[model samples]
Target: MAELQMLLEEEIPAGRSALLDSFTNLERVAEYCESNYVQSPDKHRALEETKNYTTQSLASVAYLINTLANNVLQMLDIQASHTSLLLFL
Candidate 1:
């Protein structure tokens, strides 16, 4: 349990940083695509595809972060219950 906690503590921040970086990159790409679209309307389909791919990537990263958070919360709840039971004993 302690090891799990330690691992989560180490990983959660890294996962968060990754998620933030993905968002930052998506924003930059969207801005670039927007500017380029204005200059070349023919690239609209490619820009749309890029937007779709980035949106999917963001969703996947967000889901991973959410799952990690839920796991951490569940671990904390189990730890709390165990501690309470130990005190009661």
Candidate 2:
């Protein structure tokens, strides 16, 4: 459990940074594509859809991470209280 927690703590920030970097690169490419590669209305619409999908995916991941962290904390709190109650008894 300690190892798993430690790994999550260590990796999450790195993962977030990587995700940010990727998103930045993606935006730059998308902008360039819209300005240069997207010559048709259909292509422009496709690019917009891609951008929206990626944004939604990232938001979902962030929400899930927040939910997971809260659940883990709640579980730990419950366990600690149980332990204390047992000790008192």
Candidate 3:
């Protein structure tokens, strides 16, 4: 568990940095959001308001992962269906 945690911590920072590095607008927003997030409850509302920044950042990453997963599943289903069709033929 500790090893997994350690590995994840390292990987997450790299991934976060990569995500942040992707966009100029998002980077600025994320920087402000991050800074505000640490300050106090007052700034927390800003983070809430900047939903697009956070959502876009995550969506870019999540979309690709989801798309790849969906593609793989679809390919597997097609292959299975093809096999069945071959058997019928």
Candidate 4:
């Protein structure tokens, strides 16, 4: 039980860090697109690339959120089961 608790503690923070990193990347991409829009010789290509990167970043953030939610749910389930066992004992 302690080990499971430790794992959840570690995983939840890692998931959050990953989510933060994805958001940072998305912001950086947007900044880059805006900064280069006036200077980019190939505007269409740059826009396409930015769109693709933004899409991927959004997907990554979504997946991380789902993972973190699942982790929390699993932790809650474990605690509930432990409580039930204690009550029965």
Candidates in order have lDDT scores of 0.75, 0.64, 0.63, 0.82
For model 3, residues 1-89, the per-residue Cα lDDT tens digits are: 44345434654455556545666656676788777778757765766766756887778867645554554565566667768999999
RMSD of each: 2.7, 5.4, 11.8, 1.7
Per-residue lDDT of model 2, residues 29-82, tens digit only: 667656654565687677777678668767866765675566556557766777
Clashing pairs in 3: none
How does each model score on TM-score?
0.64, 0.47, 0.38, 0.83
Candidate 1 regions exceeding 4 Å error are none
Error of 3 at 7 (Å): 32
Q: What lDDT is obtained when candidate 4 is compared to the true structure?
A: 0.82
Q: CA lDDT of 32 in candidate 2? A: 66
The worst-scoring run of ten residues by lDDT in candidate 1 lies at 3-12
Clashing pairs in 2: none
Clashes of 2: 0
> Of the candidates numbered 1 and 4, which has the greater TM-score value?
4
Q: Which residue runs of candidate 2 sit more than 4 Å off their true CA positions? A: 1-41
Q: Please, what's the RMSD in Å of model 4?
A: 1.7
If both were scored by TM-score, which would come out higher, candidate 2 or candidate 4?
Answer: 4
Highest lDDT among the candidates is held by which one? 4
